[model samples]
Target chain A: MDQTSSSFVGFAGLASKNKEATKMKAKRRKKISGADLAFRICNGIFMVLFVIITLYPVLNTLAVSLNDGTDALRGGIYLFPRVFTWKNYETVLSKDNLITGAFITVARTVIGTLLALVMNAILAFIVSRKNFIFAKPVSLFWVITMYVNGGLIPTFLLFKSLGLTNSFAVYVIPGMVSAFNMLVIRTYMRGIPDSLEESAQLDGAGYTTIFLKIISPLCKPVYATVALFVAVGQWNSWFDAMLYNRMASQYTTLQYELMKLLSSVSNQSSSAEAMKNAGEGSVTPTSVRAAATIITMLPIICIYPFLQRYFVTGLTLGGVKE
Target chain B: MKTKAINMVDLKRQKVLIFWAAAITIYGIIFNYLPLAGWLMAFQNYKPVTGLLHSQFVGLAKFKLLFSDVSFLRVIRNTLAMGVINLAVTFFMAILFAILLNEMASKGGKKVVQTISYLPHFLSWIIVTGILHDALSGTGIINTLLLHFGAVTQPINFFAHEKYFWPIVAFANVWKETGWNAIIYLAAITSIDPSLYEAAAIDGAGRWAKIKHVTLPGIKPTIMILLLMNVGNVLNAGFEIQYLLGNGLVQNVSQTIDIYVLKWGISQGDYSIGTAAGIFKSVVAIVLIVICNHLAKKHGEERLF
Candidate 1:
């Protein structure tokens, strides 16, 4: 098996070496050729298009958010702010839940990712052991889940029975171990030659010690991959928050916060007669919408470039495997 | 006496197996695989107040009521149509990308294209739909491009129109997922003995011939297994995007089994009805997977089971 893996390993190693050597070898030479120029232009176009696609709403909403509320509704805003004003941001910031909701979202994502990694890693490592006689059945048990489900109603009822409906534990516990993620980690772990572990055992390390010092250290790439998946999952999790966390006052994840704020305003606009009867100020909801969107996305947008290297590493590793 | 002692040692070695059974069985019972019993609710006039025992058992009544309901059928139709369209488009795009990307000469360029493309897979549908709502609006970029090319004088109402909803949803889904999906096929393609490609090339084969004969054949099993696996998710027409992006104008076309469950089960307190719908969906999904797996086995391809 190692021999089979060696050829690809050698090829990748050589390619990396060539890349470094080329930088030294052609220190004075320009990197561009005719084809390279065309490719660079193509890549530049693609990169611009990709970024715009990614931040289309961010740019639009920024414009709308910066525009005066009346101007926003009059459809004067386009790619840029028209009659720029920060009143929308001011209003949304001063509102009841935005700041607190942001904190709640951050806490959930951080804490949930940590808990998920610990539990998922332990379970995955135990299952990944070649000597574990029950690994096959255990793996099959988890795999069976990818095919069928208990359905939403029963799962909700189960959560209710477990008293997870109103608590913070509900956010993380039910989803701590995703079978697909476990399988990914396990497969990657399997690729680690058993002999490396056998040699470690010869050095007198027990299962737990070997797992902690040897396996865990060696599984850094897989750990990073798992961490990324878990973090992303936790960051965007609102369906659970919406489903179980009623009393909209309790815990509002950012996604849930945006949905609540946006949907409520939309719903309110439909019942404008009711709003008029209530004598609330006529706030241009579109301004608030843009401001709220910006608030919800700003953290992710800020974090994307920082996490992007890890994202690429994790993705390439996963992609190279089945 | 030594044989008996050796047998005892083997029994101790199997201790972890027992632990695995104990742990996973509990997990299977608690979180997954166990919600299956919720199918009972589908037959009962379930009331949370009454609990499970006291609910009136009415066989096929929920199914009958669901069948009779016009909205349910419409939701099913929309679900199937969108599901099929998405599968078709995503599969096509994924295959095209896998082939095109493999043909690229610059390894650095291939990596860059892939990395940029896979970024959307990390985004929540809330964000993706937010982007779409802006991009598909009356004066959005899509409309701007259309008008720039003299395609239309007026901006098209994309999100509101039912006719446009499926295509928009398909396009967004394909954009988000095709890159990620293509990677598996690409990996399979890469693993094909390069000697085969060499052999094909030596026989006066062009790029297309090598791709057709060598690359496609190399990944066919992966394709089949993935096909079998994906058929199981035919009813999952992506709830978040459809739910969040959909307005009253397109609600009739946007509601799926998952969305229906959310509405009737969670929102309206019709838990039994929702469970029935969910159970029905799961059953169909499982059946399709089994059928596909069986077909794959018959054709001498890899089968999941």
Candidate 2:
């Protein structure tokens, strides 16, 4: 008798669920309010405008980069190349400083991201250990670094004193550990179950062994996120090169080379000289700057879509604790 | 004796952890904490030749000079104006874009729009500024449109003018950040309970009414927390864009606190004055953050700390 009565209730629940689903379907079909319709139309139009506005500048830059240098100076190019030429790119890619800069930028990005990830992850792992005695103090020690800093001059002075100036190590060493990234990694590590470590320890695995063989492997997503952040930062950073490595042409990064080009173009007088020197008159400063801009951003654009999924998750994970 | 034995065992167990911690701690001391000693330069008439040790102490004279300087005052004004404008414009646009995106019916289309929107955030400032320069050039699309529409007989040199600097900076910020900032709000919106929306629908509330009552309140905490965090960073109006886009024509308007520091501290080799300006900026930041966090706690909102 109990079973029969439960079955009857379950049937009633299912019927109500079906009724609700149908109601939702009907509601979705019956959207006829003029105000609502107007909002939808307006919203649609706004989204299209937003997309165009966001894209048009980049697209226009690409167009300028592809167009004939002299023709582009007349400045009617908008979306597509009016007079197509590869000379701009050929000119930009052929420059000695730019080539050196690209090599340095790529090397720094790769090396910096790897080193930073490992250091931050290890620090995070140590703090995240539930039984670690100095966890709270160590965490606080790093977190304080986020708020207070030595400021620009002192940092510069310190680097200069340390002989980090005019060296490749200047880029990789000073930024090896970010407090924010460490915290994000710590937050992720904490969510990991302690049982995994406990079980590993029971099998006579040491802390280092557990960290390497167990914890780090499980942290692929957050690592991807942090790596992307660091790589992008390393790639985009030019101020350090401008500041510390200004005299070290060998250590110059791509962004700095682009910056030099951009300033020259903006200055107008030097731009005419720059144009004439570039590609023997086929590449104007405008075209060359656009091409350089495109080249500098191309790697980021190519990798962005692929890494988009990781960043969204990473951001949310970091956001949760912070 | 028993307690000592237990302590030994605990220490033995923690030996590896302590080793790693000590390594990182040393690094932190050198890279992070050691920089604080440089703050003393603010109190000195520092010269690189004499160094920090032998530099003569000047007891707030540099701060006094900073406060009294006309250019410094102008720099402060520019910083505050640009900071406030950027904060308000970017904050509003992000929220508005998020809400509109949330209201869209087609999930696939929304995703595509969002993907496109975030394309600019990945591009470096060098690239963004380059694009801005081209678009704002006299012969660029903006002037071309303006001239074609008979808005002006002559092309307006956007970068040459002082009046357009702040708006252009703010617009550049909005263009670069709006889509990226919207991600957090969009997350907050998605996490809102669907039952609440259903209940509103059942109560015969229209779309706008449902959004007003349900969606806005749901994301209020996120909005407040982010706002507080941003307010603390008010002084960092951005050095790169201003420094990049700025020229001799708009130096008075374009110069910010960071640029002022760079000029006095780095360029002019007045390390003391630069450090003083840096300290001022840092102090304001800390104070603002503390106040905002306190306010958030008092108002029963999420506190960053």
Candidate 3:
């Protein structure tokens, strides 16, 4: 990525050959010399300050999630753990904290992302084909969707009609194809130079073979981009879980499980009725929510940077065809 | 080739398209477009059992209620306020991070920062809020830090404070997406021709000037396109973050239209009003997109259409 090595390469390149020319300019720069120095110093300070202010709360939260709840409440922890104990984690990991709920979350995320990719891939490829007569209408359909959506109640009722109101499919099926992902993909596939298909045809390859062996492999950036979106969408999603999963025993994703736990904790400190229900069987509201959220975030966070590299290419030069 | 061309792709052989399109359109029809019928409920005194047509039409009564209601007014204000803050913070932080990463000069450093920053984007709001809850609680890490630094005598109870709520929301947004958002800018930066930088440097232009002129102008189209596209999402200030981070203490400031629809429409079973709110959001989104597109066209920027 540093095409010819370190910053030193660029810096030295900027310095020596251009020294006298830089010095002549430096005299002019020296006119506001102190001010320029002040400006640069200010820019440096502000940048660091911004990063800290932006990152501190999140880091603090991470520290809290790792801290003992009782000690965390007592204000004993700051910057680092005062009482470094895995008790909160142990409390969370125990099945008493609704381990089945965690399983349901993992299942939903895996199943939902996979289904979304499959649905989007199939449609995108079809839409990508040059002579596909229905492509215009299909693409228009996706475009209009980006602007307007029917509200939640109708969507809920729509899911209910399909008997998805309480089931895991409610979360997975309705959201299978995002318009953004579809369009980006269609834009990408359109780039495959129709001659590739012609050449494939000359070699006697069928459309299916062309798509599988050629198009899919060629569109790696879009594939990675779409996969990341689906994964993130499924991972961070608990609202649907809350909306559909009205029962405590129902399959709750990690997000919903954490929500159920946190809300219960707040409800406990806030309401006696809620407190009575707190830390009860199949739900250790306090520690489990923390654990579930951390656990659910693990895969996405882990995969993010690698995916981000491809994501950059996907956004930048990736859409050259469309 | 002649034999295959003569045989052609008959409908029978087009089973792949048929099966796949059928599978997805079945999804689209049921989940996406079919919900349009629910908009009719906004005009009806809707009952689930009686269904759409049979439900008595109540005209613009719900919309009237929405206009006159103080809560509705508050909802709009809250939505706009948070939405603007979220947009500004996310936009700037993303650009800022992209600039910083550009300066880092080491691939490993860029990769590490990119990884740390993007991790949050994947976590559930449930997890993020949980983390914030413990961090910002009365006796939490934030208070402890401030107390240690003597910034204040005690923890400010961040989640409950109305003033802190929006800032927290904005910061949370920046945390989750600033890096992810920067990827677009970084991409745009990479597209900036190296020759332009060389020319600028030949004239002895410093790093800052090069960025202001060369890099910034180069990315202006990308920025403008993204801005127009994002105009449609202004009303979508996000639901999960505000819902989870905000409590009664900050409810006035935190309750956006989406949450209002959730409370009055869904939670309480008022489908008509919920649909009305939904219709309101859809209308605003459409209007924003149209206006932004029109404005982009007028300015001769790349039009989304």
Candidate 4:
């Protein structure tokens, strides 16, 4: 658990050490040998190529989405739009299902992330208490849920029986308390000093007061990390939308709509029908699909910078179990 | 008297904790443990009309049916093949990418590259698959590049071919997850004592030598733990990607156990067989995880439990 502190120091120290190493090796540059230089050059080139390969498809999709739908089918559109127009976007945005889907996606992301954060944090706080009698059993109870569970059919049947199907609750309730998330938050909470809680308790503060006042504030970083995880998961999740709410168009999600659009474009006959249904002969399935794809991914891409900042901490905290 | 007083105070303090625990415990049983009761459906000829209690008992029949079915067997094969391939390739590439990124001289350049690389990861599978379809389509960049490079006489329909399906899925996974997966390994690498690298450098070890001796061994524990964790998930080859990308042409290779369960359980309405398949998968997952944990313990490495 303390590896995080040492790792940060290591990273900070390495950057300066690298500068010193380069300076010390400057005179030995001639003796460095062509092999090492070649490796460095190749590695640099490889990183560049890797970045390009990673970004090309995304940028290409953007180009296709922006290009005239009919012109995009001509097919050499790579980096930039050939015949630029927002018609494809307009068409995708204009779809009634997509609009409703976007609303559902946003609502679920907001409500689910907030609820899961509070619930998981509360559980983490309880288990994190040093003197709590039920802490061990409670932790074990949730931890066991991580390893074994009912499979999809059983889970689906359970949800169906509970009348969660075709409802918005299906999106948030079943996933309310992720065992992995609880573990991550618990791990972070355990790192907090016990004296803080002890001092708070001596001040006549109750467990809930200490948790809400002292523990929660100190745990902001972990909360941010877990919030990003839950938000991204909620936004990106389509399987639930497809599984439980497929017949309920009112509860459709953005990802599900994109999935539908994707499948329509993938299948030949439906793609032709989709092409005609666009009502404008200029808008093809390819462009519409690309536009919808871009739209679906827009929120994630927008928040990715923020996600990147917290994810490493979250991942490492969850990853290294002792 | 003092001990009893302390016990009473402890019990009083436990009141709030007990309420919280009770709430979560109830939610846990309902959501996590309760669904497991539905496993009984696997042993019966389940019918929606009659329900689980009244359904006729049929012992081991659905499991037998699954084993005897060729498609079920093929689905298992596909699931294992894709899962193993994805696991191997993504694991190797993440390690390799972390090492490569570590070797870069420019810190800013490394950060930029890493950021761009993982951009695909946050996108939903639907979007990733959509990008895959667009990129691998006949008129797409892959075929265009192949045509331009004289690799093929004409454009190739990548999705329609069976031989290409597994590789395509593997590649998509690698592209989507390599950077994200590397984050853990990168953290591991960062934690490697700087003294080790200094010692290696003093020994006149080259870049490759340092990577081999210091970096690889430094991250060995992390790698082992992650590998063990993934072993339990080998059956989760993935449902969304396979289901989304699969078509009539490539259905045989593309269908995993999940899709098989979905087809049988939901679409086809064979609840008994679907439950049987689900049970088999869950059993295998738990068994694999327990075995891996045991092996890790014996080997004196990190055990997941």
Could you give candidate 2's fraction of true interface contacts?
0.66
Residue-level lDDT tens digits of model 2 in B1-305: 22423366667878999998999999889988888899999999898899889999999998998899999899989988999999999999999999999987654466667877788888888888988998888888899999999999999989888999999999999999999999888888999999999999999999889889999999998899889878988897669999999999999899999998899888999899999999999998889999999999999999888
Q: Which ten residues in a row have the lowest lDDT in candidate 1 chain B?
A: B1-10
lDDT of 2 at A119: 93
Tell me model 1's lDDT, rounded to 2 decimals. 0.73
Residue range with the least summed lDDT across 10 consecutive positions in model 4 chain B: B1-10
lDDT of 1 by residue, B29-112 (tens): 788865777778999999988888788999999999988989888888888888888888988878877877776554544555
Cα displacement (angstroms), candidate 1, residue B237, comes to 3.1
Clashes of 3: 0
Better candidate number, 1 or 2, judged by TM-score: 2
For each candidate, give the interface RMSD after superposing the true interface residues on Cα.
6.7, 8.7, 5.3, 4.1
Number of backbone collisions per candidate: 0, 0, 0, 0
Write model 4 residue lDDT over A254-278, tens digit each, in one string.
Answer: 9998888887777755445655766
Model 2 ranges off by over 4 Å: A1-28, A269-279, B1-6
Place model 2 in a CAPRI quality band.
medium
Evaluation by lDDT, superior candidate among 1 and 4: 4
Tens-digit lDDT track for model 4 on B1-305? 22423376887987998899899999999999998888999999999899988999999888999999999999989998999999999999999999999888866567667777778889889899999988898788899989999999988888888999999999999999999999999999999999999999999998889999999999999999999999999996678789988999999999999999999999998888998998888888889999999999999998887
Q: List ranges where model 4 is wrong by over 4 Å.
A: A1-31, A269-277, B1-6
Give per-residue CA lDDT, model 3, range A47-72, as digits (tens). Answer: 55655654565565556567665545
Measured with DockQ on alpha carbons, how good is candidate 4? 0.58
Per-residue lDDT for A81 in model 4?
A: 99
Best-first order by TM-score: 4, 2, 3, 1
Every model's TM-score on chain B: 0.94, 0.96, 0.93, 0.97
Tens-place lDDT per residue, model 2, A1-322, is 1232233346556545656765686599975678977997899899999999999999999998999898887778999999999988998888899999999999999999999999999999999987778988999898888888888888999999999999999999988988889988888889899889999988989888999999999999899989998999999999999999999999999999999989878877544565566556777878888898998988998777667667776666666544
Question: Given candidate 2, what's the lDDT at residue A11?
Answer: 51
